[model samples]
Target: MSGRAAGGGERLSYFEGYRAIGAVVVVIFHAYQHNRDPVTWHWPLEGTTWHDLLRATDLVVDLFFVQSAFLLGRPYLRACLDGERRQHARAFLVRRAARVLPLYYTAILLVWAISNPILPGDWPDLLLHVTFTQTFSQAKIFYTNGPAWSLAVEMQFYLLLAVLGALAQRICGRLRHRSARLAVLLLGIAVLAGACDGYRLLAVSAWRLPDTYWPAWFGLPAKLDVFAAGLLLALLAAGGVRLPGAAARRLVGAAGIAVLVGGSVVRLRPGFPETFVHGVYGAGCALVHGASVLGGSHGPRWARVRWLVALGGMSYSLYLWHEPVLRLLDSHGLLPERGTAAGFGFTAVLLLAVSLPVAWLSYHAVERTGQFVARAFDGEGRRREYYRPLPDLPAPPQIRDVTEVLSLRGRLPAGTWPTRD
Candidate 1:
């Protein structure tokens, strides 16, 4: 989602799979947007179930938000609830910037060079984007690259989450019981999420702003509820809550998929309330992620498929470049003819073919390099190291399980608890 591995040398294959699927869905949605004949189907074409469903793919963006929040929030939640050593805010933010900014800035410059004309007022727009404040401005929200608005929202969330984590670290210290601390933190997150949802509703109802208004509906406040859903998942995981059995975990996951599909379908109906749409969608995301977390060492077999995991690794680049690539294809007459099912399918496939290799390159050259650089700045002196396999060497240290570490806390010395930070 943010091109960063999970904290503590762990990976959640299911979440990676989700990113891959969500990224592809978004690319397809964009292809549909640019390739569809305005005269025939038009934007927001109603009474056509399949077309409407394609349009609904826009909501998959929310899943990205949830994934980012859950992955990033989990470690902080563990520190608060389990007394693990917390990552310093400086280190946390620096790593976040490295994960996000490199590809983002490159995308902006490429988009501008390819599409936007240099003008007197363009500098300010570019400046806004460079600062990640583009979402706060109506004109600049989708200025160069449209999908980058979500990146802006993500950047804002990073700052907010860092502050909240610091605050939680302080507040959690005074609480005597872990349960009470967990309860307090959960309540705080819920209340904040509620306030955000209420602001979103007010924008639509009282301010008479359309849900499609970028500045009104796409900013950090409007999407914090979705992130809060992820934060709730992190809290549950940190608190060691699990479903009763594997059967229950599987059932819950199935139900989560049902809810996600059902919510998208319900969202297609005319005049559905904006108030409930996000809440339902976020809930579904949380359920699915929670089930995956509880499902044991390796999640569902499909999640670990080689190609899917690789695609997931490069999803951020795919998301960044797909729209511009789609436009380039259209301008060069490379896209298939518009307005037919066959044409749509061809366009989607063509976009993937052109975009996938570019994404792979970006991941290796930009994302991985940025992460390697970030590791060099680690405050805890954890450097990226390479090792060779040898029969004579002792077995590599196994990645410690968070639950196991927590369980052994009482027996271990206070300063000796196993920690990645």
Candidate 2:
């Protein structure tokens, strides 16, 4: 495959396929988690490879972080490479908040409303969820929506990126070779992230610090390596780096699979340090993402398959709502019992049947509305009045789907930009 230069407004369909895959795996993992007692009681289901694979599916969440970092970092990195100054820090934040908050807050409020008892004691924790601070403490992470702890960690990434993006623009403004400057910046970030992950591993493994999954696993510092992996991939692509041949591509792809599977196996072990395990997992995901894009002339035709794209489109909503839906069904005893294979199959089918449609509706109702509002703030359609293109620099690349921008962003159009000077 010819090397394609990743650009400002291109969609990486291959990554979307991964998104669809990850979202479904997460849903299945959550379902299994909720019904673990009964599911594990069964003989074949308890110790089989199928059961272990389902248990290990939770590792896909880190893949989401890797995807997000690349997609989110692409545009800003492109803008910096293009020599655009005058950062819109305020507008940038508004765009980020607008993209995520509507559905997120709605989920939080829904949990609060339906939750049986909101005691006075729980008020502070509730506030943390509302403020997206739930990841800071172990206790607050699973109070309302169980899956939202990841969202809290992601929000921290967004805020950090927005601020650092602004700073990078200012610092890189005077550098003559923007690509070299970006490379240095990315390297610095990668090193800093590696150090953070190292410290976290030491804290857990050497110091006898608590390795509670919620606080230890969910912290931004613990996950920065994954985000940095994504960032570096994005930066390299924008700088027009490309993998060369079939052999190289295969090597990269195989390495990615090894890291991902190896890390998952390590993660599932009892005494392994989570920080190192997840760091490897995150790096593996980043490698997979980069190899997938760089190795293909166009993304795999399979990525364009209708059902997968549809699933990818609603992945966010599905991720957010599936846990609550499972809890609701479990509470009412509407879901099938998991002790028997037949019952477990029925439960999985029923959950998917019900959850996919609900998630689709939620995407239309909440996620789309949030994107529309965010675009309004970003001056999408109204760019003539509210937006001003800088005099000499290139116009920012136009992305087709707003949701993609919020989630994975767009793909770099092939053959559109020069691969080298």
Candidate 3:
């Protein structure tokens, strides 16, 4: 697609709002992202209470995962369906690498700079971050920064996108029917994902071993479904396919609320039979998409909570800096215990206390600077150098998506494609 052709369109405003929510939810989840229980003969469901603050919040990560898949997959999936599938495959990989790696490695290096040099396998862990394949490894993602683990997972999804995306184009080219192509992609995804999940749980009992003990890189098989789910959602959106409009949105929104509330219900009653996970959780994905899509495309109407949006703007930075700050407090005993209301309050307030300013400057200094530098390098040849665009981003100031900017990078200006100035 030409620059002009790609630049004009209505993007999803509800999703931008939803992105803010997803990022914040994930950040909250990451603030206290995990639950601990000793090995037992009984199912690990005990003590995993819905009212339990830390455990309850872990659900937020699910929101983050779904959002990541939707946003990243949109345009590429569009290009594939447009018979220009090959166009995005290269730039998508490059742009994705650039967007993620700089901030990612900087965080990793910052951790390395402060920690013991001689710690066991520290060098290898650092190597993992640099290669952007750290998710496949078993290392605790950041020694000081716990949230980076999810970032690693997100990157892994991108890598999966790069590979599967190329194959998808090849397969899509042979099939003339859009419906057939979509069907094949969906079915491949379903079979592969279900197998992977099964393998991850039943076969890979090696969770107890160090990450290196497992031969695979990044639980690729296990997590493939999550990424596939996102990819399909993107395909749906990019094709101009609309799910249930107002009515569907309301229905799905109600369902999502029910599932979320069901967690609370499961918590309040004994022997309530935790039905959320094993029964129809994937349906919730479609429901959330319906709610967001059906809400329609419109800007924020309320003047109130604008700062929340601004803070949401810096959510990525907060993700980067919040955990370390929390760790700093927790190490010093500034934090309250985990189960108490006081513990949740302490974690939340302490995160916002330092994160607001830090996240703001990070957007300007780190994210924006990194973006500018990445863009400047995107133009090909000797005129521009170093980390040129990966071929997905829309050109700077052209009102294109992020991928188009990368695609414009290192190219001979933007007016024409398959042409050199």
Candidate 4:
């Protein structure tokens, strides 16, 4: 199956590359937290250097948004015009939700069992995470699972794609030429939103702005431009779009890289609509444009491995799972101290040893299985039932119930696994 449906018709495969790299960067950024000892883990880089990397890692999230829009938009656009497109929307939505919810919910459940005081105690926090809307409002975003916030943004983007698809259908009425124009117009909305926001911030005074400012408002829409850019590329690919010339393509690519870097540095202020303006939107748009025109493995040779690509496929799971595990290790004395060289070195080795296996196994076992089941059943309820606590939430009983499973290579005898519920 050509990695796409048979004769799938000029499927945009560019997203697969960046999507993988973005996931890796997020994990490495989080792992940096565990390797902070100046004595042991210390080498050539300073802590500030690592911090800069972490802060910049947020740009990777925007890449995910662009991919989401491009991949999700295609089916959505098709559904708007053709019966086949409509027929596949349910399956498509299921595949996306399945890819996200299982691992997210798994992490949430694991965290629930731990019951750390750092997490919010209120029911609202749980509701927010469960509904995939935590990132929408500022109340308490990035709770138990810090990275899930982006998934919330993606969920919101899903809603946006639906609206765009409907609007696309209404404006063009199934005419390919009209559809292309309307798509370009939507793409402009993405670009204009960015330009207008930048203009407002440069032009307006803070005191004159609205009283209730929301971060998600400006933040979420900033990503929309990136997604829209990718969607536009999809239309271009369908219509055999090309850069004006080779030189023009390279210059655009260079400009895109610059915008991506700059967007990462800009200060994101409140009081503007998310779509209309934000640094990330510009960065995301730049990334989408560059990827659309120049994509074909521009990175080093290491990025081309099947394992790297596979890890990229499960990158979301790895990203969501890695951080909490590192944090828990640190909190539980499993990780080393933050400032010491010896402590840092110890933590680095410990984290690599601990995280790799957990990540690989989780990807194969719970994540892969749950995702398959999710896409398989494609129904309303029972199949989607992902959460089920061990009765009474007791530690020993939970451990005992798991003692009978077949062993896979030399795992510590069943009795040694942590049993705390």
Candidate 5:
């Protein structure tokens, strides 16, 4: 909570721990998908609780979206509410590009080079992915790497946030009071979220588009509600809302966990409507994240464990590479047999063992480098360049000599040398 986490000097909080847990769970979910038999492993209604939880892990992707929105939105919202200088859109986009594009492009190339023979796609698919427009194409959405679709969504969110933030800053400038500005911004976000939710319902229920439809279901429009949850959380935090005490914070956290579990369970029920499933899950994630921020302390002790924090720092790379690593292991016959409890445990453990080191390397090589580049290019970096201290000049020797000579001749008073122009 106090000290910075690994990647940069960004503040560390319970969110990093959440990132670590989410990344690991996603890896396990994919592992289960690969190893389970579709014939025997039915939906949760007929399956075990473990199976339901495994299935529910897919929802963890929304947690990443919420986290991103909260982290990025908080500063902008604070600036608006407090009447501070607004963030530059160009600088924000540049930083986002530096943080996201490098690793994403790397993953695309790596996956293409290694998996082309097995998971083939054409040049247009590659082009779409390169432009972060793959999510618009049903065929290309999961082409290079399945998890990369989320990265595409994240890129879209970044662009949208930059634009919206700039517009919000301008609008807030016209408002008379902080509360008025905050209310107007919050209402705008709420309206946007409501519109997205309506679109999702129409797509799923009325139009009868499958939830797997790329543009309607997996795209930014469908997912903005989740991001709005984070944006709202940021607004509340910016407005100075806080939990009164540890007990209240704990209670909120417990309620969040309950909502999350309850949502997951309901999601697994036979014939549950898909229209609101993701929204419910997003609400739960928001609640949990809200409690973490509103709490007075750093968080629970477990959330601050050094290794967990480190894992969280490397989580982006881990999320990107874990699936490919798992597939590689499977191809080489390194993984255990499928459909057994022992096998699942072994596969999960082996994936973690192999993937952690790879993720650590990627984090250092790609992510950290990206952060450095972002800092070197953004507004702060430009300002630093402009204000950099001038190197100490060799003490204007000619002037000093002239003063000494003038003083010796008594043409200038002692300690009253002429000032340098």
Candidate 6:
């Protein structure tokens, strides 16, 4: 329950605060999208800049991915840079599975049960969800848990990190300069991401295929740049790389804020490729994240708020459950009518009130339990290695010169000669 878990690195409270904000923004974006029926009605602020900002808040999910990559990648990057080859790739997979699968599977099953009819053909989609390959499958990507496509992307990221970690270990062995090693690692990640982006753009432009069909936007390849940004920041922060003066750092932070705000409010239509837009948005988030790490905070008040910390702690669970819960609300007629200011406002309040408690429960029941199970496995492994049985001891050599000892003592007992008795 503390900032850090057992045997884990220190918690970045600022990132935690950012997660809370990002999660809330996602919830609001979904609320507006689901409730606003453009064909039927219109709210007072529906066409205003405020409404555009609300719609564009979906970009906040990039922030989520950035934070996830930075936080989760930090330890992996540390081990790789330290030239640790015995990182136990299987153990890494098991640990990640334990942390991610429980709630993810639960959400998938719940969505399947609630949304889809019990049909024979639907089983394949369940298999895809279980294996986290739905993002690659045409029929299953948006099947049950609508928002879980990101989880699929993230799963690929995890596997890729393991591969990259090994590569970094090998490369670090050959490189003498720490800076050069870091540069090589960054360049490798950038090239890979850029290659993916280029492929996606080429496919979109040349093939004349719909962008929505297994689109690169939702794929791990397209998202790699965002993750790479986070990884780069973590690497630099960990390596204690040089930075500009304090004033310059503050200016960097300010610029990050500007880009984020500007990107959200201004809409980009279909003409501009999404790859470029997302790259820019992700860059802004990475900049903000790096600046926060360098500057030592994400604004004092937001980072320090008790409720925000709690919300951030439960952000993952909230994200998993809120969309489905909103659908349930809409089906039951609990939510207000669509396309009204009051409707949007009320839906936001109601969803937040309901989703927070559900998220809290899921965190306690699911996420915390998964973490505990993982710790138990780690502890068991350590105990086996650390608490091995001791070796047997040998008896002391017999005293062959007892008679000399008795002569020197000069005060032997009467029972010394047991044979005489």
Per-structure clash totals for the candidates: 0, 5, 23, 9, 0, 0
lDDT of 3 at 153: 71
Per-residue lDDT tens digits for candidate 3, residues 93-153, read 5655556656666766776666646666477767766665555554544443556666767
Which lDDT values do the candidates have, in the order given? Answer: 0.80, 0.72, 0.55, 0.56, 0.78, 0.71
Evaluated at residue 288, the lDDT of candidate 5 is: 81
Worst 10 residues of 2 by lDDT: 1-10
Q: What alpha-carbon RMSD in Å does predicted model 1 have with respect to the real structure?
A: 11.7
- Which segments of model 5 are wrong by more than 4 Å? 1-11, 38-46, 117-121, 380-421
Clashes of 1: 0
Q: Tens-digit lDDT track for model 6 on 1-421?
A: 1112223223366566777787888887778777766686554357687786776676677777777677666766665566543465556666777778889999998888766665664788888888888888877787787778888888888888878776777777788876777777778767866876776777668865566776446777777777777787777766666446667667877787788776654445646555555666777887876665765543445675777877777788888899989988988999987877777888988999999899999999999987776665552233125466866544332344666555535454433432211
Q: Is candidate 2 or candidate 3 better by lDDT?
A: 2
Residues 342-400 of candidate 5 have per-residue lDDT tens digits of 77878888998999899999989998888888767746434236477766544332355
Best by the TM-score measure: 5
Sort the candidates on TM-score, descending order: 5, 1, 6, 2, 3, 4
Q: Residue 140 of candidate 1: its Cα lDDT?
A: 80
Task: Name model 6 segments beyond 4 Å from true.
Answer: 1-11, 38-45, 82-86, 116-121, 242-245, 265-270, 296-299, 379-421
* Per-prediction TM-score: 0.86, 0.82, 0.70, 0.67, 0.87, 0.84
Candidates in descending lDDT order: 1, 5, 2, 6, 4, 3
lDDT (10s digit) by residue, model 1, range 207-286: 87876677877788888899999899888888888788888888988888888888888876788765467667887888
| Candidate 3 to native Cα RMSD, angstroms | 12.2
Which of the two candidates, 3 or 6, achieves a greater lDDT against the reference? Answer: 6
